[model samples]
Target: MSDRKSSGGAFLIAAFAMIPLLPVASCVSEGHAGGAAAKATGTETTSQPTHATYSCGPRGTLTVDNFRTSVKLVDPEGESVDLPASPATQQSRYGETPYALVLDGKEALYMKSGKEPVTCNR
Candidate 1:
């Protein structure tokens, strides 16, 4: 019994760890008479990135809206900055100059022009 419980707990922990890596797929209906089963409901499936928030300690919080090809950052001042993926870099890096962001799974490295690089987590 104890062994079974440990296995179950391990599975739960692993599942939780994968939450950030999961892509959020949304299916939208055209509001037709049929609802995805009548063969004419007209459902469109779109994959959207999860909106993640990261705490940057004293620098304040950042809300991220990742769009696969690009990422939008909401700064502490409620300003939104959109950054396209850097094709030059192999990693999932974005932006340049005044703002640069590098994301690795659930953790992110944010760098600004005059400040030190800050590590952020969701």
Candidate 2:
């Protein structure tokens, strides 16, 4: 009789141990579905033009494109090459425009071929 009781207790402990695992398994499955859905929807976008900036160590110089989102880099001898974004684009909120380059962290240097960057704050 005591042997039967011990066997029943063992079964009960095993059942309890498995109960917690069920939720964990379900959570992992649901997380995978969410990730797949995000990928299939193609809902991601970026605000920066493809020509924002391209930094290749201290050797490459990026030439701004018409759209400002794409860039072509000039090599040491002035050879040009296209550059794609290293990482996927990130979302920017309301006040999130890329500022122009700064020499002393206080200058904005975004300008066109015949234009100059200006500061006009009231």
Candidate with the greatest TM-score versus the true structure: 1
Instruction: Give the winner by lDDT.
Output: 1
- Expressed as tens digits, the lDDT of each residue in 1-122 for candidate 2 is 99986775565445334433432443454465787547634533333343344343344333433222334433333545443321112121111122222111121122122222222111
Ten residues in sequence with the least summed lDDT for candidate 1: 40-49
Give the lDDT of residue 79 in candidate 1.
71
Q: Where does candidate 2 stray beyond 4 Å? A: 1-44, 64-77, 82-122
lDDT of 1 by residue, 1-122 (tens): 99986775565455444333322211324355444434321221122235889887777888888775678988765678987665432134666457667676666676555555566677
- Give the local distance difference test score of model 2: 0.33
**TM-score of each candidate structure, all chains considered together:** 0.53, 0.22
